[model samples]
Structures are given as structure tokens and as C-alpha cells.
Target: MGAAYEGLSEKTRTRRFLASVLHLTETMLDHLVDDVDGVDHVALALVGVGDDRVGVPTAIAR
Candidate 1:
């Protein structure tokens, strides 16, 4: 993935990968929050966005 994204400018590549991962991650979390009983997502904290992946805190809730 890093090799594939190397052709893109640094800023665009970072944004594109982060957006893709975040979309997939948010979709999974949405499903979990919706299917499980008494479950709620409080916040999403993104610590960093790397070339191949993103660093984000997992779902937190009461």
C-alpha cells in the first residue's frame, strides 16, 4: 500500500489513506453500536495518520 501511494503527493496520500481507513472503521463501529444492547460510542480520537494506517483510540462509552 505504501508503495502504491508513493506516486501521490505526501499530503494527498495521507488524506486519502486516512479517509479510507476511517470510513471502514466508522462503519464497523456503527454496526457494533447499533447491534449490541446498551452500547454507545462516545468519541473517536485520531492520534495520527500514517501512510499505511491510522492511529485512533477505540470506541469509548459509558
Candidate 2:
């Protein structure tokens, strides 16, 4: 997830958060991955399948 976030273009990141999000704080990461009940909030990731990029999200849906 961190790797994926780091890969986001500045324009994409800004569009996502409605601001310039340079990096994820631990709390933000926890919230993104852990908080928000699935009943109301959901996130889906499309990740790279293998090699050094394994598990890195290529795209995401929320």
C-alpha cells in the first residue's frame, strides 16, 4: 500500500485527497487499511502480481 501510494502521481494524489498528500502518516495508513466499516466504506486495490512490484496497487477503487 505504501509503495502504491508512493507511486501515485502528484496530480492523482491531489485529486484523491482534495489536497496535496505527499505521504501517508501511520495513522492515515491505519485508517485506510483498518478503519471504516465495510458496510459503509470499501476500498479495492488492483495490484501488481509478482517480482519486486508484488502487492503494489496499480489502481484502486473506493
Candidate 3:
């Protein structure tokens, strides 16, 4: 998820996070991960196939 967030375009990041720069600080990531309810709310989609997969999330809702 962190990788996916980092891969977002500047425009998309700004729109989604309402910030010119989206910084996923360790503290922020920790908070997100610690939120059990938030875990349930998140959704992600990755590209590529199987064990060789490598990609960013195409969509997210949280």
C-alpha cells in the first residue's frame, strides 16, 4: 500500500489527499496499519501476475 501510494501521480495524490505532496511518513503508515477498522475499509488492486507481480494499486478506497 505504501508503494502504491508513492506511485500515484502528483495530480491524483493532490486530489485524493488534498495535498500538493503526499508524504507517507512512518508515523502515518503505522497509524493506518494500527487502525483495525481502517484495515477493513481499504481496498487495493495490483497489476502483473503471480509471484512475479510488481505494480501499484489501480484503485483505493479508505
Candidate 4:
């Protein structure tokens, strides 16, 4: 999430977050992660596929 957040453009981040969010603290990330309860909510991480079968997450959805 740190990587993804850093990758977000300033405009994109502001529009998505509805504010001028410079960055998310580790505590904030933890809260975001913990907010998902399997029964009610979930997050999906999208990644590129490669022949080596290793990839970095490109996007995530909640």
C-alpha cells in the first residue's frame, strides 16, 4: 500500500481521497487493512502476470 500510495498522482490522490492527502501513515494503512472483515468487506489486489510468475501489485479494490 505504501508503494501504491506513493505511485498515485497528486491529483488522483486528492480526487480519490477527497482531500489533500500527502501520505498515509503506517497506522492508517493498518487501519485500512484491518477495516476489512471477510464477512462484510474485502480487498482485491491486482497484479501483472509474468512468465516468472512474480509481479508487483498494480491496483487494489475494496
Candidate 5:
């Protein structure tokens, strides 16, 4: 998840998170990942294979 967020372009991050920064502090990330009730809002990542394996966040939805 952190890797995916770091991989995002600044413009993409800003658009998705409504912030000017490309990265969030660990504390902020933890807060975002916390679940409420039985539900959790999340960003789904698609990971590649082998030595090139990397995560890319594809969607964020409730």
C-alpha cells in the first residue's frame, strides 16, 4: 500500500487525495486504513510479477 502510494505521480496523488503532496505520513496512512464497523475504505493495488513486481493502486472506493 505504501509502495503504491509512493509510485503515484504527484498530479495523480493530488487529484485522488485532494492534497498537494505525493506522499502521506505513516500516521495518516494508518488512519486512512482503519476500518469503521465492518467496513473499510481502501485502495486496491495490482502487483506485477517476478523481479519487476511492484504495486499500483488501481481504485479507491467505499
Candidate 6:
């Protein structure tokens, strides 16, 4: 017989995961704004978490 799945609380886990995703998204947005105006002091620079961090920098050519 398969393990009991009835004890798993899907709703709670889903809410927690969504909250975490929202927080990370907000952090990215804050970093974006800081990089744009370049008029404020930012504690954490925008850097990738893993092996994908190294890449070419982009500039808004206008």
C-alpha cells in the first residue's frame, strides 16, 4: 500500500511557498530600482545566487 497522503496539509504549504516567492520577488524589484536611479545607497547588490551569476552587464542606451 502507498504511504498515507491524508496527513499532508497542502493548503498551509502552498501559502508558505507563495509568501516566500512574493518576498523574493519584492527583493528583486527593490534591487532594480536601486540600480536604476543610482542616487541611493544599496546594501545588497544584485547578484545571482548560483552558477548563473556571471554575465554581461546591460545598459539602457537612449
Return the top candidate by TM-score: 2
lDDT of the structure predicted as candidate 5 = 0.69
Tell me each candidate's TM-score. 0.22, 0.58, 0.47, 0.53, 0.50, 0.19
Candidate 4 — which residues are off by over 4 angstroms? 1-9, 22-31
Query: Which has the greatest lDDT?
Result: 4
State the TM-score for model 4: 0.53
lDDT of 1 at 26: 49
Per-residue alpha-carbon lDDT of model 3 for 1-62, expressed as tens digits? 78888899999889976778677888878766654454555545455445766564465445
Q: Which candidate do you rate higher for lDDT, 5 or 6?
A: 5
- Candidate 2 achieves a global lDDT of 0.85
Error of 3 at 51 (Å): 30
Query: Higher TM-score: candidate 4 or 5?
Result: 4
What's the C-alpha lDDT at position 52 in model 4? 92
Cα-lDDT of candidate 6: 0.41
Candidate 1 regions with alpha-carbon error over 4 angstroms: 1-4, 19-62
Candidate models: Cα lDDT each:
0.49, 0.85, 0.69, 0.86, 0.69, 0.41
In the range 1-62, model 5's lDDT, one tens digit per residue, is 88898898888888877878766788877777865344445454454455656555555554
The best-first sequence of candidates by TM-score reads 2, 4, 5, 3, 1, 6
lDDT minimum window of 10 residues, candidate 4: 31-40
Which residue runs does candidate 5 get wrong by more than 4 Å? 38-59
Which residue runs of candidate 2 sit more than 4 Å off their true CA positions?
38-62
TM-score of 1: 0.22
lDDT by residue (1-62, candidate 4, tens digit) is: 88898799999989878898988999988868888887687888999978999997899888
Total clashes in model 5, counting residue pairs 3 or more apart in sequence or in different chains: 0
- After superposition on all CA atoms, what RMSD does each candidate show versus the true structure? 12.6, 5.5, 5.7, 3.7, 6.1, 13.9
